[model samples]
Target: MKEELIAYIKSELIGDDTMEMNSEDDLLTSGLIDSLAIMRFIGHIEATHEIKVAPQDMVIENFINVDAIADYIQRTKNS
Candidate 1:
């Protein structure tokens, strides 16, 4: 899930397939991605994982980085 998120962010969101990113990287605070990008990313996650992301679930803690997003997806799925 982490790899897929990274790949999607690099290829689709940033339009730079070769860009390098780590699971622990600060995607929000580091200016790697902005608010609009985050929304699109959430849409991608919802569609790809088939899990509905409630508005309340769209928190910074769940989207700080790839690792957090992956964990969020897992938790949402298990629930």
Candidate 2:
């Protein structure tokens, strides 16, 4: 799932080299992604995971790191 997330993020959102992603790393502060990328990521997550991301859940602090995104996915799935 981690690999899939990284691949989707890189391929769809960034369209750059996928080899640069680190599973445990944060893509936000690294400048590998930006604010706009967050929206794309959210959309991709919702579509791929078949879960809806509420508007209130769209916060930078909640989606800054890969772990956060994973947590969000878990929450959405469980809910």
Candidate 3:
């Protein structure tokens, strides 16, 4: 799931196949995703993961990096 999420983010959202990013790379601060992109990704994440992302769950800490997003998904799934 982590790998697939990263691939989707890189190929679809970021649209840069050559862009190398680590699991801990900062997507927001690094300008990999903006407000509009994050909104779109919220939809993608919810749909793809079958998880609900509440309005309050939308935060930089949750979506900062692939690892963070994956962790958020796991936590949300458990909740």
Candidate 4:
């Protein structure tokens, strides 16, 4: 999931195939992605993972990075 998220962010969102990103990278704070990109990313996550991300779940902590997003998905699935 982390790899897929990173790949999607790079190849699809950022449109930079060569961009390097890690699971722990601060995507939001580092300016790697903006609000619009995050919305698109949430759409990607919902369509790909078959989960609904509630409005309240769209917080910074849940989307700080790839790992955080992965964790949020896992928790949502478990619940």
Tell me each candidate's TM-score: 0.95, 0.79, 0.93, 0.96
List where candidate 1 sits over 4 angstroms from the true fold: none
lDDT of each: 0.91, 0.79, 0.88, 0.91
Q: Report the error of model 4 at residue 15, Å.
A: 0.8
**What are the per-residue Cα lDDT tens digits for candidate 1 across 1-79?**
7888999999988899987789999898888788898889889999999999999998899999899999999999999
| lDDT score for candidate 4 against the true structure | 0.91
Give per-residue lDDT, candidate 4, residue 61.
96
**lDDT score, candidate 4, position 38:** 88
* Candidate 3 Cα errors over 4 Å, as ranges: none
After TM-score superposition, the amount by which residue 2's alpha carbon in candidate 4 deviates from its true location, in angstroms, is 0.8
Q: What is the Cα-based lDDT of residue 49 in candidate 4?
A: 90
Q: Rank the candidates by TM-score, best first.
A: 4, 1, 3, 2
Q: Write the per-residue lDDT of candidate 4 for residues 1-79, one digit (tens) a residue.
A: 8888898999988999897788999988888788898899999999999999999998999999889999999999899
